[model samples]
Target: MHAWIIWLPVCEAGRTFGMDSLGGWMFWIVCVCFSVWENAALKVNMRESSLEVVRGDSVILPCSFYTSSRLSTLNIIWTLARSSSPETPIQVIVYDYGQVIEDPSLIGRVAFTGLPLSADIILNYTRLSDAGTYRCMVNNLPEKADPGIGELELSVLEPPSLPDCKWDGDINLGGSVRLSCSVAEGVPTPDIRWEKVNPEEIPLPINMEGDFSGSVQIVNVSSQTSGLYRCSATNIL
Candidate 1:
């Protein structure tokens, strides 16, 4: 619905009167005369409130609207605010009547999945940078909607790369050594796990300390600490 507000010089001065009987009466009259409410008939809703997809994948953002307005007057706009700069919105696409206009930066990679009848759109070759909030706004002019905007949160997942394991310092008995494990890249950063790989699958030595940051230290290493070690990295899909 729409609420139109108008300001008059007298209204501003009335506030200084401290809401006395006369001031209160004038305020009520001004509100009743200057503020008007018009009921809206349009309705917009999002089909999927949120979505998650892997990097390099294609994803569809769904939006729908119902209005008694004619098709010739319908206008739909799609905008996005990337997670990096959430306050700055970039127009992704616009459907004015029957013509479709796409943002230059996303041209050839984005297209309307369902046009004219729906506001759904598809994004191809999704990247980690594409993770953000998307908005769909529909306007039918004279018939304002209570909520003409729908929002969807998009997340792009990246799996951890193959981990590289190495050691610093000597592995000899009574010597100190630092075992390091790392992945080239990963979204949400992968967790690193280090384990001693012995024939009997024995427990790790008490002198060994491991860290999720991909490092393990063994102080005063002994026979118990001398064995093959494995490092594994994992992250959410």
Candidate 2:
């Protein structure tokens, strides 16, 4: 009976060891798979964070990373890849590994002025011809890391100037004449006003058209109405 009890306990111990061995192997396999997956994911994430900018104005593109705190030694890069053509490169705007990479096209134009986790890149003096999609790339980071991308749309507008005023109708005696005042190409629209310098000093009949065009008519033209008519236009900055 003593030998029988001892054999039963030995059998139970063997079974427990076998199960534990299997569990340990499975755990190791899972850990290895997760490590590989995490590296790949970080690589992808770094590639996704890269971005671009326009020519005439300023643009801020963010490039950041999220990974284990121990991997903070990773590098960051920002490049301007031409739209639709990745092989033909325009310029490397910024490449910040431990320090910043200086490129001629981005001289005094690009700046990286934010923390590593939240990078704020500023590009100034954007132009209309610089309108295109840009690719911002962050490289040499961990796998599964995605780089940031930004698209900029730039528009250039020439400021409005004072337009020439001319008499649209014949200025005749005893007949009404229409003097039109106009200004071209303003954002907020220009102000138009007409002033009559005559003996009567009466306000001329003024009709405005869409903030830019204005017409003033002098009725019952006489020698007394023979005075200088002035049309003034002021643009809104």
Q: Write the per-residue lDDT of candidate 2 for residues 44-144, one digit (tens) a residue.
A: 23233333332344766544545553444545555554444546656545545557764677678777776455444666785433334455554444443
Model 1, 55-158: lDDT tens digits are 99999999999886677888999999999899998999999968899999999988988777888999999988888999999988778886999999999989
Candidate-wise lDDT, in order: 0.81, 0.55
Score candidate 1 by TM-score against the native. 0.75
Backbone clashes, each candidate: 0, 34
**lDDT of residue 161 for candidate 2:** 56
Please list the residue runs of candidate 1 whose C-alpha ends up more than 4 Å from where it truly belongs after superposition: 1-40, 200-212
Q: Estimate each model's TM-score.
A: 0.75, 0.44
Question: What value of lDDT does candidate 2 attain over all alpha carbons?
Answer: 0.55
